[model samples]
Target chain A: MTIKLHCFGESGNAYKVALALELAGLDWQPVFVDFFNGETRTEDWRARVNPMGEVPVLQDGDMTLTQSGAMLDHIARTTGKLDGDRSEILRWLFWDNHKFSTQIGMTRFLMNFLPEAKRPQPVIDFQLGRLKAAYGVLDAQLKGRDWLVGRDVTIADLSCCGYLYYPEPFGFDRADWPEIDRWLNNIQSLPGWKHPYDLMPRAAAA
Target chain B: MTIKLHCFGESGNAYKVALALELAGLDWQPVFVDFFNGETRTEDWRARVNPMGEVPVLQDGDMTLTQSGAMLDHIARTTGKLDGDRSEILRWLFWDNHKFSTQIGMTRFLMNFLPEAKRPQPVIDFQLGRLKAAYGVLDAQLKGRDWLVGRDVTIADLSCCGYLYYPEPFGFDRADWPEIDRWLNNIQSLPGWKHPYDLMPRAAAA
Candidate 1:
């Protein structure tokens, strides 16, 4: 069955789902929603699917799924791309969802999305500290290990790399995290690495 | 193999793992980490497992897994507790992790864990708004359905209920969410609801 992903054109969360589909070599149709016009909040759009009024909702045949992490897990499980010891793969996947995605990704968003006048200096400082701490954890985990889990790339890497690379667009330095920098470069060099980001040009900012 | 979960007693994240195991009818042992004494930050604990140094790490024999959402998904999949159309189950699970778990759970933590002097009112208000908005989405989703997904209980419900009930200890109001309240009561009455929580009384505040 062909999978169709509905999401805003310039979203890292949506890119997460798209990147996984590309890595898994799965065919998917991208249904772009215009975030500038508040398309996600529309009742017709939300009520038809994803009552949460969020994007990156994937529809496969008759089934629809949300949450980039969960969707990635389902795709990985179904396509037999979930490599490594089952428990280990799960461990990395959870780390991506909880720590990396929540702390780092959200902090990146706050740093990027908020207007200069509206963005509080303390909030930015706090999130920067969190991002650094989180990166330290990821850096430590990646020490001497080629991948986040197992030897080969997995959904965990996809989920994390999508957000980890966002700092560049926001003009943040990646110098402190040499391992993470290498990992990001590795992910960028992968086949179809640019497909999702290409669809969202605004994601790679000045 | 006996499943062992290492976590502090009052953590909602830990409760998520325990709830999934119980719902799946899997026997597991709970190991407490005394956060009060900084047990989680020890190098021995970090080196042995969980480089993230967070709890609700599940150990199945020789395999160790951390991250509560991923752990819950693993248990659900292993025990066959996740039912309904695979796509729908996947959607709800993702919502549980990304939306409910991230937004609502984080708000509760800030309100409870951060001292009043350090807790910014604006941040709290913003998070509270986000939580209420997300809860509205869930309440609407639950309007006609007894469970979050499918006919029976699934990990989606367990994940959502775990976070919703967590605020009871912090004196968060539940009366505004009647369906949520009813659902929380239903899950609390389930067998083994108290076992993991009992093992870590401080983690299960209410």
Candidate 2:
């Protein structure tokens, strides 16, 4: 049976799972969630789809999974290719969720998705400052290593690169960190790689 | 050799690991990090300890691990308790890291740690709003359940409960969310439970 991913193009969290699915060569398809229209917030959607009210839910027959980090773990375990030091992979994934991707997702939403007049300037500035600190750690970690763990590309790589490919300004400039720049290039060079927009059903389908 | 956890009282991240260690019956000790004095970010501290410049690093002989979520997993696996549905456990762990604990940590820092005049009101307000939504999800999930995943208590509970115990003002009141409040009580009533300040050496102690 083909796996179904409930996702949206604008969601980097969704993109992380999508990237892992594509790279693993899984039989999967995207079912876009109209996040911008508040579909996920609806009571019916929450009860039936995911009570957590988050996207990128993977439907594998009777089994359903949410959280991109957990989804990546499922994919890696099933395929046995992306697995690395379990603790290390989880460390980076948790860090990305805690510090990196979460900050960028909200920062980008404020900077690009919110109406110009409604944008909270103070919140954006605060998030941008935090993002810089997170980026510094990631870039420095990548300086002497080819992968996040003692490995060739793991889910940590797929997880951290989730929000960086979007054109929207989230205070992230690849050119600003040479190590991250090279790492991005390395991920881009992988076979069967696709940008988030190219791989998922976009919110507006533009 | 005893497991060494580099932590401080103010860090709820470290508290998650500390709780896991105590419950798992692991012999461990907390080595304080002077976060309030900017020790984690100094060049020497970063070089010698965690390059990520963060606390809650677990040093067990030749193996060292960072990230509280991962540290919990290590403790759980090593001691053979607190394990549950892998994907479900991870989902809540990620949600706690991405939305619950991280938001509270920052909001509390802004509200309590920063000088009164330096606090950014708008940022605090925005984060408070986001935190309310996260708390709603958690409270609803715990409406009839005693734990975050499965029938037994797991690291997910430990992870999500990390920041809720702090006395600092981050706009959270246990009375406001009955389910979450009850769930917190459950965790607190666990055997060998200790407050974060009691479990770890405080920053001011230095």
Candidate 3:
């Protein structure tokens, strides 16, 4: 009874759940979604996999969950490994979805995935500014702590680190933020951490 | 011992928590933040309220919480209402934060809040297009349903309806989406419901 995650390699949101699954040693396998080829845009895919037309849809037994934050919460609850201060963990997860990963996902897509002519410079600049602010909040939060919530590596770590590990140019240079760099290293130092590309199938070279 | 919410009238994220508190009949008051000015940008405010420099920070006794989704969970937990289908509700909350309200908030800010010359037209156009897709997803979900999750009116409703009730032109025309319009009416019919401006104080007339 392996949990199947409907995801693609380019999705940091998907990687959040994938990282958690790998860390927890859950019986799970990645189900590739050909996003760049427009597989998710199909009506049949929408009705069957996810109506939201998004990735990282976790199918566990009869239950299917969308939104990487919610899926991470389910993984934390089921495995009981990354479950720490409830409110603190939830706050960070929500923040990651609403701000951090959301911005990085789009910025990275525009910078690396989209055609060069179609890349909107103004939009990219605006997003980069906002992401710098988001990076500041995350870096400040990690000033003295290894993990986001408590001393343990909760889903908060997995959630916030969704897009940071990607090799693409998403306006994120690890050397720019010392504390976040250290924190990411701490997460990389986990037992069974896998890079996003190694965990899920990528649609393209980017 | 009434709860205090550090918020502004214009923030949809703040309005989510405000709606939950009002619907739950909680003894709470809105402590206005001068976001239209430089209040939230100040280091002192960042340290005292939220390092994220965002609004809708709920202070219940000594416990303070940021991110509207997290605060709504608190209100739901405390009032014993709007607490149905934990995973489903969380999914929608995350969706709203990640997609719906996030885009509307930015689009509305550019369309109305920001100075005319300062508004980024390319960015606004980009966000408006994305907001249309988000609206389509929401409208489709509400086609034959009265609420986002479960039969009961959960925090999902409160969260998704955050920016919809605003008068600002965020590219959302009620007549365009019939299902979403009907669902919005259903929420408006809820007892003790208040519009964003009515629920909290605005900085200036827009």
Candidate 4:
């Protein structure tokens, strides 16, 4: 059965699941959601697709799953790939959702997607500060390790690296954090790894 | 063996785990972490306690667990309580971390905990807007449901209701959200349920 991922290219959250599917060599297809046009916010879409008004929804046969973390877990568990120390993997996944990727996703959107005049400077600045702290934590965790969790790459790595591959400037620079830079390189070196835009159909103009 | 939860009263993240432990009828003790006094931010604490530099660290004999969502899962699994449809429970837990509690936690800290002069209006306004959207999603999910996941209350309920129980204003009013309000009442009605402040030792003055 083909796993259908409802996603847009601009969404790192969606990209996390897409990357997992690709790396795990699962049979999957991308169904682009027109998120930029407020499709997700509409009552019809929310009622039919996801009431949370978020993307990265995965439909595998009778199961429809939202929340990229949950989707990643599902992929890892079902495929027996990207699986690691369960507790460690889950810890990083929760942290990424709570502190890392969530901040980066919003910050990137505010910095790049929003109109220049409408961009909230103070909010961006605050997010940048928070993101910096989160980056420090990530870099520190990666200081003497190859993967965020166990001895091998896991869903934890995929979850944390969700927004790092983006070209948009969201107050993050690879050169600034050598640990994260090297970690990103490690992820990029994986077989079948593809840039998010190459892997998913993008809704926003490049 | 007794479980030791490193937490403080002000942290809603910690409250999630605390509430789960209490409701599960586990023999647990709260080892207060002085969050406001910069304990979690210390180098020693980060290295020794949690590299993520966050709270709700649970220790049971040889195992040390961080991340409230993961801890909730651990509690539910080990105690045979608050466990339900694994996928549905995880979906809501991820959503709560990514959208609901994280925003409310930060917004509440800025609005009430921070010095009035140091509060950034734009950041607070932005977070309030995001929090409102999250509240709408949660309220809509609870429209005709007694719990967030499954037929009975699970960690999903504990996770989402973490920040909602806090007295600090984070632009969330239970009165404005009737469904969430009623759902909260259902949680409060659960035996052994305690307010966050009551369940944990608070570092801040009430």
Candidate number achieving the greatest DockQ relative to the actual structure? 2
- Output per-candidate TM-scores for chain A, rounded to 2 decimals: 0.88, 0.96, 0.97, 0.97
lDDT of 3 by residue, B120-180 (tens): 9999999989999999999999988999998989999999999998887989999999999
lDDT tens digits, residue span A83-107, model 2: 8989999999999998999899899
Model 4 chain B weakest lDDT span, ten residues long: B47-56
DockQ of 3: 0.81
lDDT of 2 by residue, B1-206 (tens): 89999999999999999889888888889988989999998999888888778888999999988889999888778877999988899988998888889999989988988889999999999989999999899999998899989898999999999988877789999999999999999999998999888898877542
Each model's lDDT comes to 0.69, 0.90, 0.90, 0.91
| Model 2 clashing residue pairs (backbone) | none
> Of the candidates numbered 3 and 4, which has the greater lDDT value?
4
lDDT of model 3, residue A150: 80
Best by lDDT: 4
User: Candidate 1 regions off by >4 Å?
Assistant: A82-84, A167-172, A201-206, B23-25, B81-86, B167-171, B195-199, B203-206
Against the hidden reference, what TM-scores do the models get? 0.88, 0.97, 0.98, 0.97
Across all models, the iRMS values in order are 2.5, 0.7, 0.9, 0.9
Clashing pairs in 3: none
What fraction of the reference interface contacts is present in each model, in order? 0.51, 0.96, 0.76, 0.75
Clashing pairs in 4: none
TM-score of 4: 0.97
Candidate 1 lDDT, tens digit per residue, B1-206? 78888877667778878767766778887777776567778999888766677877889877677777667667776777754555566566566666567565556666766676877666667666666777777777877677887677777777777666542333246797777777777677776665435645463234
